[model samples]
Target: MNDFPWLSVLLVLPLLGAITVALLPRGRDALAKQTALGFAAATAVLGIVLAFRFDSGGPRFQFTQSTPWIEAFGVDFALGLDGVALTMVVLSVVLVPLVILASWRDAERSGGTGVPPKRSVKTYFALILALETMMIGVFAATDVFLFYVFFEAMLIPVYFIIGSYGGPQRSYAAVKFLLYSLFGGLVMLVSVLWLFPLSSRKVSEGGLGAATFSFEELSGMTIEPTTAKWLFLGFFLAFAIKAPLVPVHTWLPDLAQQAPPGALVLIVGVLDKVGTYGMLRFCLELFPGAAQWATPVVLGLAVLSIIYGAILAIGQVDLKRLVAYTSVSHFGFIVLGIFGMTYAGQSGAVLYMVNHGFSTAALFLLVGFLIVRRGSARIDAFGGVQKKAPVLAGLFLVAGLSGLSLPGLAPFVSEFMVLTGTFTQYRVAAVLAAVGIVLAAIYILWMYQRTMGGPATEQVSGLSDLSVREKVAVAPVIAVIVVLGFFPQPVLNVINPSVETTQTVLDRPGFRPQITGDVAENGARP
Candidate 1:
């Protein structure tokens, strides 16, 4: 059956609308807003359509769209999706439109002439849509080289948004963020270029080689153990910078603190996942031997980052910086689960990516509201906020519980599965990572206690509860946190098959990985 290229449409529909919005006449702020919302809503609808038709049983790169793009380099515009990709696509769709709504009230974009800022709402809205396009493409890309292009392209709009619409230090933060990402990307590109000869099957006329960017094609190649080791680190550094993994992770807190909350939410919640997802999908799969070889080193760093991030979070007085640091800690759990190399761990790692996005988005959004109300992100700036804003307190509590991985919360199941899977493999590492859970409670609860409870400060005396619009905006996200916590079966059902498939490929005879669990508990089994 030849249906349309639904996935390509999903990626481009938003950009087309963005271009349309961008070209509209100046001062047409209202039209720009309408166009952005419509475009975003359309993309979400397309994602929903794709989800229903997604085939979980087969290989993921389905509904694929491929064409020759760079013939000289052998790079093709190939794209496809599976359950893992679908989960990410759905998350992107849900979040981007909500971001549009969240940023709607700003005077520059809200069509409020009285307080309208200097930037054009049209360009701002167009950039947001463009971002959605790149984000979706990053997940859907099947070609390693194409994936790299989309991965690096995402920083452009985000840098603009941060520099144009953020705090006084926005430009500084934006430049730093871009430079860090570019540096990492350049490293990855070097590795990707070197990988071509090993990845391609076709020999060139001059005894050179044709490049192959397709994952399926590259999977057949063989490389020396020594060479694989160096290549692995090339890709690792790029993703680590984005994941903001410790030492390389310094750019995140600054970016979050200076950028607008909407920008913060998308950057951390969705864009950050591209890093960990890359590790799972690319690093572990494409370089299995190197992955096994580097496991000890990466895991050691993961454990250190877990404790270090939580410790730094505890010390932060700025609420936004605190949240950002917790992301560092929380992502460490994902890293631990990833290297565990078990079904439960990998499944839970994917789940961690999904649930973390939701909870972190909620936290950032709520904190943004607080800043709007009190004009500060400092923890000491607010006291007794719950008394004045019961609704806000309740929402923040939901987000925090998910972060702390409380039972029956969205993150609870994922965290439990991740830790449980790890116990079967790295018992000591699992125990230490569990301590990360305890640190989670400390920073999250203490942050809430300092910011939400105690006596009301003079500034907190008269604030109102969440507006109807705000309530409507956040209601579904909170509901999803609860809903997914209860019935993750729908997603789990889809994710397991694909995860097992990857596990099988990596479990090839060539790999001597330190696997755990019983003989009967093989990856192929349910």
Candidate 2:
């Protein structure tokens, strides 16, 4: 199993599917949808197989493969997975088919009430499959250069998806998304280029002996403190924009308002995770000293994002924008967990990524259904939805509650872990961050009441319940949320080991471990 090219195959399957879907003759939209769904499902099955074969206690990086690509620069076509990467891979694969299913009618002219998609149905599905390939590749790439390639290349399909198939302001939104991402990428590229010469220099001169982009090699090398901080900032800027943390998070609500709901699912649900994941995998691992140096400021920004996002969400008139703001808030929690620098904190942060994906996906899809029914995304455009579509209302409520991290839901456990872990170290920050939870309940319930409660308004009185396809699309996500809420130990078991490895990296001298008085007394550091 270790000898198999698991990650390569996982990436290729979706790429091949995209090509096959695109090449099919015109007027076969149904066939294209089926073909794309089949390919996504197959890729998902492979991901599951890979996950089951993963040994939690085995080598840090399993199913590894490395082959020189640009040998002159020591870059390689490398791919590998630790527990964290594996969990993310599984999340991406599992969501793609579900997104495909939910978006079954997204490209068709008669699919819904809003302005129809301008692109061909076949092209739409093809873009989705192509995006899947990029998502998997970004998570799997073990070479820094290869990871950057996947990172920037992701913009292509997403650009087209939003600009071509999205709503009235899509072109503007797409351009904004592109420009922000491109600038971040360019800055990071400068940092990436800088690493080569540094790596080529001799160890006595603070070099790693050979120029290389292999993550494992680079992580093990030591760079000057000032140089490491700059590199760390470069990478952190890219991830932060992607994470869309406060201040830099301006692009997301605009994108969410304009993008098709299905595309939005992958954007917030999975794509945005690349930022948080990079913070966990690259930033902290490669520059532990800088990471520790930046902890105080990072935690401050995270707490600010948490409050700012929730407050804005409370004032949103548009359903899609409301969900988008909620995500900004949720991401703050993820970031908070990460910088807390404790085992429980990092582990919870990782699990939060997966759980948030499902909950946010469900919210966006349900909102999409509402928009389709009424031809508007405004909260005022809906009323007494429950009277006409009980199932839709019920499901929306459950998804909404999950977003608020209600007890016995998937998000609650992860949220709790993150707070528990962070509280032990950064007590004030954790306490301040908890305020976001209260605000979350306000925004979520208020949105639900306006959209789903009360007497059936004439406009929404005729709203139909979820169709069979819609039900099938959302059932699995909801099930996962409920199941994981009660039994998260399984997922935690897989995530804890990798987080332990990360803790080991962060535990070097000069980093403080404030998790408990006993640890401080014992002279333990992180």
Candidate 3:
């Protein structure tokens, strides 16, 4: 199993699919869709196989592959996965096909209320496949340079998807998204370039020979404190923007409002996760002392995002924008868990990433369906939809409740673990962050009441129920949310080791765990 190039196959299959879909005859849109879904489904099945084969108790990074790429620069085309990366990989693969299924008619002229794509439907499907390939590559990469390549490559397809296929203001939204991301990427590139020289100096000073862009090699270097902090800030700034944390989060609402629901799922649900994921995988692991130094500020920003995002969500008139703001809020929690630097906190953060993907996907798809039926994104455009489309309303309620972290739902367990972990250390921050949960309930329930409750408006009185295709699209996501809610241990088991490994970095020299009062009795430190 180890000898198999599982990661390569996973990456290439979707790329091949993209090429194949793009090459299909112009009129064969149905064949293009089926081909894309087939490839996505096959890739998903392989992802499941890869997950089952992962040995939690074995090497930290399994199914490893390494070969020279830019030898003069000491970079490698390395790919591997820890438990965290494995889980993320599985999440990415699982969602792509669902997004494809839900978006079956998205590119068609009569598909929905939104404007049809300016390009061919084949182009739309092709872009999706290309995006899928980049998604897997970003998670699977074990080299810093390679990760950066994948990270920036993601923007290309997304840019085209939104600008060509989105709503009226899509061009503006896509440009804004691109500019924000490009600024962050440019800033981070300075730090990435600096790393080689820094690593070389540290290695030579210690009697070691050459430097490398390999993650493992850079992680082992003893960088100067000030330099490390600067490098950390460079990387952290980029991730915070990607995470769309508070101040940097302005682009998301615009993009969300304009993007097609299918692309939106991958953007907010899976792609945004890259930010928090980078924080966990690179920020803390590669620069522990600097990470600890930045935690107070990061946590402060996180709390602000949580409160600000929720407060804004309550006032949203657009359904897509409402869900987008909630995501900003949810991301705050994910960031909080990450910087909390406890085993439970980090583990829960990872789980939250996965759960958020499903919950948000469900909400967006359902909202997309509503907009298709009513020809409006405004909240007031709907009322008493439950009277006409009971099944759709019911599912929306489930997805909404999950967003609020209702008990017995997937997000609840992860949210609980995050608070439990953080409270033992930063009690005040945790408490402030908890307020976001109450605010979440408000926005979610109020949105539901407005759209799914009340008397049916004449406009919505004839709203149709979810089609068989729509149901097929969302059923798997809702099932995972419920099943994981009750039985999260399997995923947790996979995440725990990586969380522990990350936490250990904080215990080294120059770093300290700040465990408070009675909570310290449970364990010395998380």
Candidate 1 lDDT for residue 246: 84
TM-score of each: 0.94, 0.97, 0.98
Which residue pairs clash in candidate 3?
Answer: none
| TM-score-based ranking | 3, 2, 1
- Candidate 2's TM-score reads 0.97
Q: Candidate 3, which segments miss by more than 4 Å at Cα?
A: 110-113, 206-209, 521-524
Off by over 4 Å in 1: 107-118, 201-211, 515-526
Model 1 residue 220 distance off true place after TM-score fit, in angstroms: 2.4
- lDDT (C-alpha, whole model) for all candidates: 0.83, 0.91, 0.91
Residue-pair clashes, model 1: 1
Candidate No. with top TM-score: 3
- How many pairs of residues in model 2 come into backbone collision? 0
lDDT of 1 by residue, 1-526 (tens): 1268888889889999889999999999888988899999989988988887877776556788799999877789998887788898889988888777777755362221122344687888888899999999999998899999999999999888777776667778889999999999999999888877765534542322456788776665666789888889999999989987888999999888877777677898999999988898888887889988888778877787788999999999988889999999988888888888788988998998899899898888788778878777888888899999999998988888888988888899998988888777777888888888889999999999998888777889987788877776677778888988998888898788878867876787776465546733765222
- List residue ranges in candidate 2 displaced over 4 A: 109-113, 202-209, 513-526
